[model samples]
Target: MVSPMITEKVISNAPYAASAVTVIAGFTVKDWGVIIGVVLTFITVIVNWVYKHRQDQRESALFNQKINHHQKHKNN
Candidate 1:
């Protein structure tokens, strides 16, 4: 007996990069889940890096302000 094939609809502009995929090569649903997970993890890492960079810039500005204030007081 032949097994029934599954069909999924995909948008042309989907992030997966493919309009449609046919799974005749024994690629299972589990494999697709892993691929998606990896992509999401990469995106999360980039977002975290940007957030930390902004935080560091803000801290540096505050530190510079403190140093300038102390220098002005010492000169007076």
Candidate 2:
């Protein structure tokens, strides 16, 4: 029974409505700050882990190449 225009409006306003509800439900500014900080920390940790993994792979490859070169020269 809902019209397309009404559905669009509700979807657009959904975030605002949810935010208002959370405030009314006693979610204070400090709670939001802590939530944001925790999310940022988690994202940072994931990024660092990925970077370290890639670096380790590069070092392993380089070491293998050096070992191969040394072995080839030694066999000559």
Candidate 3:
């Protein structure tokens, strides 16, 4: 099923492939810096979300304990 013409074309273009690959793969310094910035921003958002979730859970537990204590005193 393979064509000889296509194989010959691929062999002819193979010599220039490295330069083409480098041009595609080469990221500038600014590109790397922006990528790092975006990653850090994502991590910071996740950490803040987890921290807030834990704080809310702790506050809810304390509130429940306070309500129970007050109700017991009122019943007596």
Clashing pairs in 1: none
Candidate that scores best on lDDT: 2
Better of 1 and 3 by TM-score: 3
Candidate 1 lDDT over 1-76, as tens digits, reads: 4333322333434545442444334567898788889999999999999999999999999999999999999999
| Clashing residue pairs in candidate 3 (N, C-alpha, C atoms within 3 angstroms) | none
RMSD per model, one decimal:
10.0, 4.4, 6.8
The models' CA-based lDDT, in order, is 0.77, 0.96, 0.94
- Model 3: per-residue lDDT, tens digit, 1-76? 8799999998999979977888758988888799899999999999999999999999999999999999999999
Candidate 1 CA-lDDT value: 0.77
Query: Which 10 residues in a row give candidate 3 its minimum summed lDDT?
Result: 18-27
Note the clash tally of each candidate: 0, 0, 0
lDDT of 1 at 30: 91
The global Cα lDDT (0 to 1) of model 3 is: 0.94
Candidate 2's residue-wise lDDT over 11-61, tens digit each? 999999999998767968888799899999999999999999999999999
Which residue segments of model 3 deviate by more than 4 Å?
Answer: 1-25
Q: What's the TM-score of every candidate structure? A: 0.64, 0.68, 0.68
In angstroms, what RMSD does candidate 1 have relative to the true structure? 10.0
